[model samples]
Target: MVLEQLEQAVCPQLDYDYDLAIVGGGIVGLTLACALQDPGLRVAVIEAKQHSVAASKGQAYAVHQLAARIFQGIGVWAKMLPNIAQYRRVRLSDADYPGIVEFQTADLGTDVIGYVAEHHALLAPLQEFMQGCSNISYLCPVEVVKTQYQPDCMEISVSMNGELQTIRTKLLVAADGARSRIRNAAGIKTRGWQYWQSCIVAFVKPEKSHNDTAYERFWSSGPFAILPLPGNRCRIVWTAPHEEAKALLALDDVQFLQELQHRYGDQMGKLELEGDRFMFPVQLMQSDRYVLPRLALIGDAAHCCHPVGGQGLNLGVRDAAALAQVLQNAHKNNQDIGSIQILQQYEHWRKRENLAILGFTDLLDRVFSNDWLPLVVVRRLGLWMLRRIPVFRVYALQLMIGLRGRIPQLAQK
Candidate 1:
């Protein structure tokens, strides 16, 4: 059903009670709502924009193997199969370092390193899936004006037509983007800062085939990644100083493409800009907490990390899965899913895991993006040793594929 029809179908009833209410229609929010919905429980999702508002452009993402498994568990993968493109390998290179370091799926005994897909194409099917399920109610294009936590339940005030309406739910989740209003109202604290670098993201049509592989190249400025999609199209994420980014983005399409070619080398052959380029300031954000009294945060709302290793969405997906499993287990055990005890467990499970990933990505961003001779020598030798040792290479590949650690319940076969 169209988003408009979906919104109109909802009954105008106040004092609606839900098992869970998620504030944010982004991927993580919607996924969490869908995951928590079942025959036994009712879930609702509230987003600031109407469903008719399409997902943003110039924001494509790569999903790790664990994320692929989570999608399968939620039953969205089958619907999204047509738009998905698997990348069997990835090539990481440094201009000053000798030789290239490659991570192949075969080396890890997997079929693909990961999958690359456009944000809209992936999210539309998820929304459609949520609509068909009877347990989910989607509230879009409505601003969350107030959020109040009481001893019994969490109360939310939403504005639709300059009139305020209240929603009460057993549990409240905040999946809104970076600046989460729900999180702010809950009085949760977050710690992060903006990076000196900015990222330029754009879709380009290349003259040569990408061969279903992604490339990450490090330069003095920052890391540039070219992720291959299904067609001759590629998504480019070029990181550099904010001033340099502004200068590059101001050039005409021809001049911009030329600069891209020079920095990107001949790997993808000639490139023609297919769409407008977008620039986003980079930051490393980690929340002080992910859960509070009957409240929780997910996705960029909870933590934002550097995109050096492309783990942002993957971490969010895992958060959704972890919360879902915890709730399911609580229900099975006749426990209160929204109880502080249950919420704290969820926080404990995800906080440590999220911090580990944040630290690893931060280290990579600092070590690889630097021009320091000592750090460069150490990293080059580290890469060389991994390549030379077959066992170490396979293990590294497995880690990159998100297969090295304990598999989450939803991700388990």
Candidate 2:
């Protein structure tokens, strides 16, 4: 009802200014819009594609224990609960080396270690939630062509239904993907490199039950992860060299299944491909600064890392929660949400966490992706020690489940 009014409340010829304007309607952007819902604030979401069009773009996503809690707080988890498939434990094994590490929910006295859901599953529900919130204006089928960051407000020119429209907002959030136009427009530089590897993703069904266990097997090529999905289905993420990824994508289903069997064994029995294979290049990108004047970067706009750990989206969720709380409080206090101070506070809270997770994933990639004898020995020894060390076990479990450190209020259980 509120969104319907937002569509007709103000004429496009008049001012369409908003308190907050978020670019990109992916999970991160939509979830941020959902978090920013307040009767006191007017928020606008700009996206180039419709929800159905965007839904078909990405592969599955793993929602860690912490990410799920964040969703629960945002009020969309209840709508998404029926769509998720829980992974009770996660196992990491080295195919060439004799090291296997397992993280189980039982050890932490939790019901689930994490969960896997298609990227669309979360986004669709979140978009629905946003549409119903009166404070949010769903500006869809729009392409942002011009962005101007002013001293007090940011102006955005977008083409909606082929007709150009201009909107202004006090705070502009770049929830756009890796190549963020908003971040670039803000002149926030980033430093990172693309890895030589690419990942091939596909949905498959094992002949036997998966038993809701997620597996990450490291080989000389790269990391091969099998994430559990509901109904005895699994999603395979095989990160190999660019050449190897090309070969895997070109292979026939029989050959692909045979290769997977060779690497993963018959733990889940025969593997049958259930969907078309897709491949994407992997990279590590972190913005130099997460905020600039009236602009803030969140999700892929701020940082992006390898998918070997499934922490990408969860990291963005934490950012949204922290930023939303900061902005909500600032609005209540009659302070500017776009002020450097408030944005800096959000950046201060999330910068370390983002960099630390990036470093951790990078370390895992370097240690496990190479076949150097000395490094392999050291890595194996570390894993071996972790298994026997009680204190370390507890810590590792907490880290994977996203319960370590000072959690944001919205993400806390």
Candidate 3:
């Protein structure tokens, strides 16, 4: 039953083949299918693994309001909502600086600020929805070995269930990820750099209850975020420079806890580890072009930003919605779905917001991860003054809620 759960996140009619062929059936790919499903367009998702294997790579993600609405539009939110933890309050603080700012869900007049849920929790339901969609076909346990971009159609060659097969479509959407095969074969160039820092993550139980509060503490080392989870447990994402991250990874549970306390203080009280710890390098990546010929890139394939705001996945989901909107509109007008003209519209609409977010997150990491006196003073003053300025405070609150410029129609509830 659990294995079959991801089958119907989208709905459509009977079709063996597709008009749009999606590579990499990760979150963005599945979400794109769901977003495009309501229109009864034929779609096929080619993935590297079958349902069971791809369904449960247990990980966690914090979903912003914009993305949550996209999931609701695709018809899986109602099922996934029960397993999510809502953040009632969000606190931003610094280790060596006196700057502190707190944002409340009450201030925004919303039932929830945002959600923290396991990656599999979100993936399973979307996968289930996909299975039930008649017009959307799934090609699982396959690897994309060759991709050909033609003037009229795109061809993706894969080894499916131990046999070689090629799928032809009007458009090819890449949702693979940072190291995207679809992107590379399409000759799309990317520009980004490794942050020289790594993220150390783990789940832990704290002496004091998190009380549905999310805390992000900035230190010269990097930003450390402790997001609340059910049962008084917390998900910790600690961004530290390379050496520090390696040291943290090498420590015994007690030693690592001690170091965490030294940097994070006792805000959540004594902490105890729950699961395995992990260290991963963080980087910024952006494709030179999101569309070329009949091919398009979405999600991590198009862009990636710092995880400071937890906006990477949300940004990717927005791409899926925008692309689906353009394709849906083009279909209504009886235009070529993969035409250069139609794909350009999707590129233009998404690029504006994507660039702004990349810059904002980069600035957050650079500014907060420093001890430069003058800049530190200015940042601290800004945070302290924000509390007294009602209008400005509201403006900042809205940005955190993913309510700023140019939201996709599907993202609107």
> Judged by lDDT, which candidate is best?
2
Residue pairs with colliding backbones in model 1 are: 49-141, 50-141
- Give lDDT for model 1: 0.81
Q: How would the candidate models be sorted by lDDT, starting from the highest?
A: 2, 3, 1
Give the per-residue Cα lDDT of candidate 3 at 5: 25
Evaluated against the true structure, the overall lDDT of model 3 is 0.83
Model 1 lDDT per residue over 1-413, tens place: 46553343233233448878888888888777767656376888888876857466347998888988888888888887788778987888886466688888768676788889888767887889889889888887788899988756789899977789998887898888888987887778888788889999998888888899898888878889989887778888999999999999999988898899987778668888887899998888888989986788889999988887788888888888888888777667655556677788789988888888888777777888788999988888878877788888887666655676556777885
TM-score of 2: 0.94
Report clash pairs, candidate 2: none
Give the winner by TM-score: 2
- What is the Cα-based TM-score of model 3? 0.93
Cα deviation at 283, candidate 1, in Å, is: 0.9
Cα error, residue 180 of model 2, in Å, equals 0.8
lDDT of each: 0.81, 0.84, 0.83
The runs of at least 3 residues in candidate 2 whose Cα sits more than 4 Å from the true structure, single-residue gaps closed, are 1-16, 96-98
Candidate 3's C-alpha runs over 4 A off are 1-16, 96-98
Q: Each model's TM-score, in the order given?
A: 0.93, 0.94, 0.93
Worst 10 residues of 2 by lDDT: 5-14
| Tens-digit lDDT string for candidate 3 (1-413) | 53332222122222325789898888889999988877867899888977788877656778888889888877899988888888988888877556567888767788888989887778888888888888888888778899887666777788987788888788889999889988887778999888978999898898998889888888887898988887888888899999989989999988998997887678788888997998878999888999986788899999998888788888888899999999998778666777766788899988878888888888889988888998788778777877667677778767755678677888776
Which run of 10 residues does model 3 get worst, by summed lDDT? 5-14
